[model samples]
Target: MQRPPLDPQLAITFFYYRDLPQAMRFYEEVLGLTLAIDQGWCKIYRICSGAHVGLVDETRGMNKWAADKPVQLCIRVSDVDGWFAYSQSKGLDGLSRLFENDQLGIRAFVFRDPEGYQIEIQSTTRTGA
Candidate 1:
């Protein structure tokens, strides 16, 4: 008999930041993500779409862990302007510039998460991509 392969429903990455609680609060309270797991050492946050974001410690890691930049995480949202306004109100730093990329045909804005990581909120006119 043939068996179904194990499928991964979500994508996760270990994000190393200086402060964990602040990140947790930003993801949980500000972004309205549910706290799936909350231990002293690590935390797992789940957003409305069932995706997760993991926060990890940076102190014990190698010096390279404290790099100037990390990979950006693009989050798809229905309303980019609303979220941009909300992030601005929360004192989150966003890229001073905004533009439309003719190549990708996506409307997006870049903003920094609590740990200074880059995040993009994009939306499409169609119901689904």
Candidate 2:
């Protein structure tokens, strides 16, 4: 008897500022992610490890959330300091100051995207495991 092939899937979803194209540009151009696909209203971008981040239009008067709250997205990078420094040099707003936590052992920092969502960048070598 032949066995069926296994399948794996993982994705990160995010809300956009009523414009999917604008968000795509930000993620692709600013964040340096590649645009895998964009189906007009919906867009999916490649981040890493076969993982994708999707941008959906939630501002179309849908009951996605009661009120507009800040969304938190964490992006893991090889060089946390480089990314953080480069983002700052681009005049990007770092909402929260970078700090090291002995608990998680991760050197991390927070910044806001164009749509006002908070994104945290951290090192993969950290002892956050």
| TM-score versus the correct structure, for each prediction | 0.78, 0.77
What's model 1's TM-score?
A: 0.78
Q: Whole-model lDDT for model 2 versus the true structure?
A: 0.71
Off by over 4 Å in 1: 1-6, 48-50, 60-64
Best by lDDT: 2
Q: How much lDDT does each candidate structure score?
A: 0.70, 0.71
The positional error of residue 10 in candidate 1, measured at the CA in angstroms, is 3.3
Model 2 reaches what TM-score against the true structure? 0.77
Candidate 2 segments whose C-alpha is farther than 4 A from its true place? 1-7, 59-67, 124-129
Best by TM-score: 1
Per-residue lDDT value at 95 in model 1: 60
lDDT of 2 by residue, 73-113 (tens): 78777788888777787777654666787777677888777
